[model samples]
Target chain A: MSRVLMKGNEAMALAAIKGGCDAFFGYPITPQNEIPEYLSEHMAKEDRVFVQAESEVAAINMVYGAGGAGARVLTSSSSPGIALKQEGISYLAGSEVPCVIINVMRGGPGLGGIQPSQADYNQITRGGGNGDYHLLSYAPENLQEAVDLIKQSFDKADAYRNPVMIAVDGLLGQMMEPVDLERTPDSKQRERKEWATDGDAGRRGKANTIVSLHLDPNKLEEHNLALKEKYDRMVENEQRYERLETEDAELVFIAYGSTARIARSAVESLREEGYKVGMIRPITLWPFPENAFKKLPDTVHTLLTLEMSLGQMHQDVKIVNQGRYHLDLYARTGGVVPEPEEFIEKAKAILKKEDAA
Target chain B: MNSDTVYRPKQGLTDREFHYCPGCTHGIIHKLVGEVLTEQGLIGEAIGVASVGCSVLNYVYFDCDMQQAAHGRAPAVATGIKRVRENHAVFTYQGDGDLASIGLAEAVHAAHRGENITVIFVNNAIYGMTGGQMAPTTLIGQKTTTSPFGREKEGTGEPLRVSELLATVPGAAYLERVSVHDPKHVRKAKKALEKAFDTQMKGKGFSLVEFISTCPVNWGIQPRESLDWAVENMIPYYPLGVFKDPEKEEEDD
Candidate 1:
């Protein structure tokens, strides 16, 4: 098949379908409207189910139900819309119904702006909804990686019976990239899903129940512990990141999603000037790449976290770094996109200040 | 030499005793749903979405694949399940607080989308599970814990006529409002549920049967008196009978 140019929003929509998604339920929201619009146009042509729900709240509930019933489902929105889905996302996580959700994020804390920002990094990685739950979250820096991760997330979701979120900035969703739109579902792990609510007709005379409410405190505790165990396993196996030229670097730039791209540029320019700087880009934000903190050269004495938010992922870096190195944040918040020049200047000053002290 | 067993508990209902208060019509409504599922042979293929409130435990009583949704979100949940398994009999059981108040958008939107599913709404006029707050269906002048001085038409406005509102949606294939206070109305309710299920089986569209019910404990009255109070108060505000039926309408055209 020939590669075709596609927008990030539409690419993720097509990716889910290629990964065996049976239904799409979502509402209209900015920087990601093309996702629902594309599905609304093509789902019927493909004979796939599509519903433009009344609100993000209803859309996520539809996703929860559809996912509970053993169908591969998908939903997409931006920051404000994603906030509306928090309550239902908690339910989906609690019920352990596998589905895929995409947050092509915009500036936020509340109605911040409809522009590219990493403000939702904390919200997506930290469970924004109530309760002790963690969804496998991926932050891809480019359109290709976004499509690739989302395409693979559906099966991974089923393998664990959990929801997987793809968090990107508005820029990725709006930009166009060339990709092969080949629809192929994973044949491995095609075993029958016995846990799905596919009717009691085939099961041996017993009803299936999908619920999140554990009324008795003891039972609820048990459920919570079980979820914790699942998250622990995810941490052990799913942590992912990309490290570049950090062996002899003095300061490492830590970032993810859109900011990671800018950080990469900053590192490249610093390297040309013969300054000791490198980059570490986290692909999976939750199940965060703690392994990146395992071994470090003596020359690496500082960790610089660059983000579009006001220092969210810096917390994660500090938690893992555990004071082994001096940690700090260089961020642009509320819809401000940072240029590589500011990072080059900040990194030189922060490192020069360390030397002077 | 054995005689044919003509009558027995249908496989659609479990043996567990209901948690509903004594004299509440929830048990009656559950039985009617169970009976209809069995009669139509849809029991094995049924998936019920249990709402919050007293019926939060409805999953345990319905002998089919069941899901318990967050308060007022069962219709949306049922919509999800039905979209995935179109041939399966999917239905949602919701109370006034769960259906009319917080979940009004979910309910109305599901109907507007013409989602092929069944809804069994229990309109008891007050929130029974939360200890008698005035619900959307609570009578205009009715007294409840939240409406101690009785509801004021000038303040909270009139009680919501949920069944009538849903009937106006073109996607709704069938709509009915019935009560379980008397034997005649009980029989009528059973038929309404059966018809709603049939509408889903034929892939017609959305169908809902709202049961005007009672809550003795929350209403501050004896169980028997609550039934009389419902007949005297709720019946007139939310009248009984079908508001929309797709087959009949198509015939008229």
Candidate 2:
């Protein structure tokens, strides 16, 4: 009921416990190490399971194993570590295993840096692993939002029977903020997983096999289509975004995660200066809040995307824009955290270009 | 009264026929595991992790709950299952290629962590599912698809002795290398499997039984000839015996 100042990584870890996470399997990685470090002590105190796996591959596979056994499991890592987890993630998606993964992202094409960067936007939203798959991904802009989303991700993962990913930049991971852990999204009642391979399924007369392999081409196609149907449901029901001061705005800054916080500040600054600037912050990056763009007023013509990566989210904006609006992008790479002033400058240049044209 | 039945289909194994190659020893090994679980009355509480290989579909063959893990990741998967389902008899049925090659880290670390689980490692010395490629346990001078002329000791290392390697780990409660080339050794292999499972049920840490198995089709030999080949070649190198037995050591002490 009371608020406490907590580190971002630690808050997410505590939120997982509140969300009824039964097990955590992860290997150490930079900027996100606190998640495991905190859980190692607290998970045991709660009489839950905690395993420090040998590598990211082992950790995620462990998650697959636990989830296949119908346990609420979680794993956290940085960008490169998440890249290592793609193989297991693919298997989890293919098998329809429910678990939550947190990527307190840092820069990377390959171990680029250990500072805050949204470079994993594409990796988390798109299928980082092979084949056609998608995670219900969230990119929260603040510590409180990150905590709430991390708590709700478990139920959402169970509801969809798929992995849910929370992608936050390293800044959110390392920053400290006051948060009320008691506040959580409404918990969806989870049906018992009768298909889980926890021995009980066998004892009850119908043994279960949690597998992704469908050797027959026809069967594999059927499975893929079934998964596509689930994903389509997510797109219809789960698109989430926050619109800020966009009623009569002509220019909108599109961003998410830490970048969105910066864009919000820029929007405020431009509004104070008598410029009609607004922002659209996407909370769910996978079923990316395309509805937010559709609701933009007729006066809005230009959409500028700001990102910690070099235009990863910008690609999504372009797709949803469909030539409906003038699009532009401003980005910083390799762990560079751009300031609000930069977004303001970019917005001004974009509007000036539109006026000139 | 009717004469007592000498043998029956194991309740632990499902009705599905094994998909292993005709000459492959995976069937014999699978039977041993199935019988072990059934005999110990652990079938109802057992959870098996099936690894990728010719035995990838062992999930269909095992009547108990099963999880098919990524190639070589069965050990890690079993660890995850056992940690959560502590009362369940969790085990991984992995081939030499799956346990000794890409999944070596997961296998060794699982043992090192003293996870209370059993691993049924089938060391056939060649990759069977992928058409006779050289495996980590492929012996020197052996010819495989990948080692066309023969396996060179310099180009590729000597066969990995997984039982001996795991025996060195302090957490391993039981480690044994057995073969099923003959009826006597087949019984011995099943006994080793029983002991490994018993260790897990008793809450003792990691246990593994390595079967020096044969892949006849991959070896380009008759099924009958392959048994003799395994006895003559593999036993000398992989040496059948209990490599580590913490329970026996305690009794000796």
Candidate 3:
């Protein structure tokens, strides 16, 4: 495969085109502006549609319209832009339209900062929109993963008839890493005309209505129930997590996205210092690896959960643990990323406390 | 003569019935939109965005891909649907309250950006869905639930002329205002709807056709009398005409 050093955001934009995405609709926001800018230049070459919407709301709605027409479409933004798109995302989720939404997350809690942060774990996993719907969220750690995840997002969205989000922190968007452009998946095999609104010629007898409305209470209930069943199936099939040195470990370090990379470094240092510390990184935030935590033995006395936010995923870790063991949460917010040395120090203190107790 | 079958409403709408009050113009507008979709053979390839108002249940009435947006957010949602599915005809059926009030920003931006979609703005001068309230297009000195002592130009300000305001936006391709008070007006309004949809199909960008409708129950008048009042009072404040034609402007440009 031809290797090329590329920024994560640029890789994602190229991957979307390689994945046969027909349109790109987005508004400019920091750390993710490269995505739209790249599409503006490259989409015309591929005869694809690229629209720089007046606002985030308009961009996301354009994605919804394009997705409804059965075209592989995408939209990208940072925290503030993602906030503006929440209503549109909710409607897209409710309508069961397939599309890709890239949130190269920045510091937030209302215009906090533009630095990279994984503070949107709760927002992305537990429905950022207004309805009782779940979007398939993929957390990418590097430029390669960013490209691969965007390519896979289309298939996952179409397979489930739902919106798929590639939640990358601003670090992944800005960081340059070597990516194999030759290994990009070709999505030409996917038949779009079967369900897309690409003119009505071959299928004359059947009338297709792509609506989410059911006036009859019973029919609406049935529709919601079917969606729930689909979600349950996804929970069973799509739960993914990475384990590093879980075997013969006293403590397990839990993290994801960029924080997980930092955790890996800390784990490596702690192992060199003769501490039995391992790490568990969740790739899919939704349909979270609830079983992974349960698989750990009673010997694993302490679980350290690290994130860029204040203990958002720690709540899920505690819920999964069900009070079998206590969990320690460490976080740094407002665009500050915790250093690996700080995590190592924390791990050392927890181990000393265990020994003292 | 086979007159009985001739006047029956098209089969696109189900017989489950609507919650709109007797003589409400929503049913008539719904019938008109459905008929256009049927006549153009665009039913399967059309997606309708329903706005929050008396006609929020437009999803139930229109036999096509229907989506409901928050208040006046239908244009934004329709923009999304149209961009992704370029071949599908996308339209937003919105009320004056939904369009002129909270969703004003979305409407203006969509028009300014020239999104290739159709907007069917139903201006009844009052918020019929959320009880009678002062709407953006409410006539000055016209009474409603909010303006109990009659709309005061000094207090509530003047009614908004949506077509005129939109006509000023450079991206708008076609902007027309029509009423549905009489049979003649109804025919003309249908033609306007067709032209707006045609503009989108030709990829000519944004097109909006505002239908000055009636809310008889909220206005405290009979359906026929409400029509007369709308023609007399509303038409003067919000005149009926094509405010902007992109083709004509292009020749001038």
Which candidate number maximizes DockQ? 2
Give the docking tier of candidate 3.
acceptable
lDDT per residue (tens digit) for residues B16-72 in model 3? 588888877777788888888777777766778888888887776777666667667
Sort order, DockQ high to low: 2, 1, 3
lDDT per residue for candidate 1 within A97-183, as digits (tens), equals: 998999988988788899899888778888989999998999998877877788789888998899999999898899898977654
Alpha-carbon runs more than 4 Å astray in model 1: A1-3, A180-189, A201-203, B1-11
Error of 3 at A250 (Å): 0.8
lDDT of 3: 0.83
For model 1, which pairs clash?
A: none
Error of 2 at B251 (Å): 3.9
Model 2, residue A296: distance off in Å is 1.4
TM-score of each: 0.97, 0.98, 0.92
Give the runs in model 3 whose Cα sits over 4 Å from its true position.
A182-184, A193-206, A211-221, B1-19, B35-45, B250-253
**Candidate 2 docking quality: incorrect, acceptable, medium or high:** high
lDDT of 3 at B4: 69
Residue-pair clashes per prediction, in order, are: 0, 0, 10
DockQ pick, better of 1 and 3: 1
